[model samples]
Target: MKISIITVCYNSATTIEKTILSVASQTYVNIEYIIVDGNSKDNTLEILKKHENKISKWISEPDKGLYDAMNKGVAMATGDLIGILNSDDTFHSNTVIEDIVNFHKKNDIEASVGNIVQHRENGKIVRLYSSKYWTPEKLTIGFMPPHPSIFFKAALFNKFGNYDLGFKIGADYELITRFFLRNKIVWEYSGITTTAMLVGGLSSSGTSSYKLITKEIQKALAMNGIAFSSFKIKMRFFWKIIGFLKK
Candidate 1:
């Protein structure tokens, strides 16, 4: 099965090469790697040019935001399965994509979710984010499958729609809630560590950002007509703490 991996970046000069090399080193050959750059003013473009052969396609242009770039990548994707790997992150192993393909070879899963290991820039392991306990019902509390570890059937975007531009920080949460609960899309747990995510990304800033995302999460659920409260959204942090403590 053909898979498309998208990496959205902006001035990620310090880390994007590792991200590119990780995708280039994948064991699965039938992969399309697309990158959407936000007109990076750094050496990021130079790096992209340096590894031009390894990348299937790339565009360095100003975009609305991360989700906008991701939507562009999705529009350009022709693979059967579509995934997003951030510029600051890398695949957990070369076989990550191969394992996803093997899992889906047996069935036509609409979305495949897996695990991720978030770590510091120093390569110190932070915690393992697993989809083993995730359920569609958890959307009521703002829990979602790890975004980087998710691979959706390309058709899901055609049917359900792309990331909602209306959101600033909760589009992925909104999309997952819409897919799993609103549309009842068929999904599975791949039991594979898909991405080694860096600790600080779009959704992992500071306390103020946390509060902002929590409010956005509430807005996302309400927009989908899913019943949720601020308390439930706050409960998500408690679960995150538990996740961090779980080795």
Candidate 2:
């Protein structure tokens, strides 16, 4: 199946080149590379222009935010499958996309995801989060596959809808929960590593991270039609700390 990889960026001149090269180097030939930039003031647009020949489609203009940029990319995607790679992230290796496509084809899966390595700004690998074979119960306790490592059938978007622009930091989390938990989309868990994501991303940084996570948990619980208690939320945070420690 043809796949479209979207990279949404803004003022990411220092790192956008690596993201572009990662997608361009993919071994999968039937891939579409689309970049949506939010009118960056930095050299991000210049870098994109330099690689314009490799990009299937690119646009640089002001956008509502990251999710809005992603929505724009989704609207433009014409491939059978869609995946997103953030400007600060890269595929684990050149063959990653090829492997994902092969696995999906062989297994007849609607979605596929693998492991992700979280790395430092200087490209030092920090932690690895693996995608467990998914189950509805796992989502209740906050287990989620890394968003960048996920590839889903594009038609799923038509049924479940796109990322909710109403969410600032937790839109992706909400989307995943809505699909995997509420809508019960079929997915395959590839045991291979897919991407290396930069640590300290918006959802994992600063005091606001806590606020956004709280909102995410609420969103997930509401979708699952379950009531959440403060104690359970605290325990979930405790388990998250434990997961980090294990890393």
TM per prediction: 0.96, 0.93
Give the poorly placed runs of model 2, Cα more than 4 Å off: 223-230, 241-247
Cα RMSD (angstroms) for every candidate in the order listed: 1.6, 1.9
| Tens digits of per-residue lDDT for model 2, 1-247 | 7899999999999899999999889888999999999999999988998999889999999999999999999999999989999999999999998998888888877788778999998779988878765455566766668888889899999888898888878788778888887878888788879889988787888767876687677776686575556456546768878766886
Best by TM-score: 1
Residues 95-179 of candidate 1 have per-residue lDDT tens digits of 9999999988876689999999999989999888899988988888878889999989999999989999998988998899889
Candidate 2 TM-score over all chains jointly: 0.93
lDDT of each structure?
A: 0.91, 0.85
Worst 10 residues of 2 by lDDT: 226-235
